[model samples]
Target: MARPRKPLLSRERIVDTARALVDAEGLAAVSTRRLAAELGVSGPSLYNHFRTKDQILEAVADSVSAQVDLSMFDAADPRDWRTALHDWAVSYRAALTLHPNIVPVLARGPGRRPAGLRLADAVFGAMVAAGWPPAQATSIGALMRYFIMGSALGSFAGGFVDDETAYDPADYPHLGQAHLLAERQDLIDARAFETGLHALLDGLAAQYEHMAGGEGPGRPAGDASTPAEASPGHP
Candidate 1:
């Protein structure tokens, strides 16, 4: 028999099958046998590309990470840090929302995943270049990841059932409208994300102001001291 013009199996196909399984049925559903069956190949054939299921899962997680838009962090002007961070958070949340099942693996940190490392590096480097101390920059990166991942894990509004009787006004007075929330899950979640994001950035801006004002362990000696100069365009 002639060799198939298109390869029957490859690393990309394996990762794609694994990711699809994760997206549809969660990480527990992914396995070398499951993937091989999905790919219409013998299970051992998968070992030719990935030594273990963990490696395949890592590739799947990295594929989702690669979908995020890190370009904002590469802005020419460091003053765009606030905007960059905001945009990056949105992009990161979007990628996770699509594949919430894989978030647990990603939460373990970049590990040896190249794309994950780049995401972390971009955020950390941008914060430092924007005049933040290295320690704070590290904290900021961690904070953003926590916030974005938490948001993607589940929907706050979606927790309620549309069944109006679920609220039981007397039992949960404050939640008089809780039952209505599930129907508006998307809008509520989006607004909540934006509200939280703005609040976080606003707090950071205040801290930036205080640090650059020379009242605290201000910016390094060679760095600009004035708030306007320290983090231009900060919100």
Candidate 2:
């Protein structure tokens, strides 16, 4: 028989199969044997491309990272920090929402993932170039990761049952209408993300102005007194 135009076993096919498994059945669903079966190849064929299942999962996570838009962080003609950060956060959240199963792996920090590293580098570099102290920039990256990942992990609105009777008015007066949220899950989640994003950027903008004017939290922009315990995360 003639050789197939496309190779039967390739790294791309392996990663794609693994990613589809993760997306459909969570990260635990991906294994070499299963991937090989899905790819119609022997299990040993996978080892030729990936040494272990973890490596395959890493490639899948990095593929999702690569989908996030980083153009706003372009050093050549960068957008203002606030605008760029907001766009990046939205893009990041969108990417994670598509592959929430991988968010846990992505949360493990850049490690040795090239695409993930580029993401962290862009956020930190952009913030520093925008005049934020390095520490604050690090905090911003961490904060964004926490927010975006948390949002992707699950839907707050979807958590509630659509049953109107679920909320007992006597004990939960404030949540009387909470049951309605699940019906509008997508709208509520999206608006909630936007509201949170706006609040974060607005707060950061205020702090940036204060720092630039040498009066933020009793320290100037270049001052090293700001609380900066947080470090950047992977996604």
lDDT of each: 0.83, 0.85
When summed lDDT is taken over every stretch of 10 residues in candidate 1, the lowest stretch is 226-235
Minimum summed lDDT over a 10-residue window in model 2 is located at 226-235
lDDT of 2 by residue, 118-189 (tens): 999999888878887767777788889898888998999999998888889898989988988989998999
Each model's TM-score, in the order given?
0.89, 0.89
Off by over 4 Å in 1: 1-4, 75-79, 218-235
Residue 71 C-alpha lDDT in model 2: 95
What lDDT, from 0 to 1, does candidate 1 have?
0.83
Largest lDDT belongs to which candidate? 2
Give residue 79's lDDT in candidate 1 (0 to 100): 39
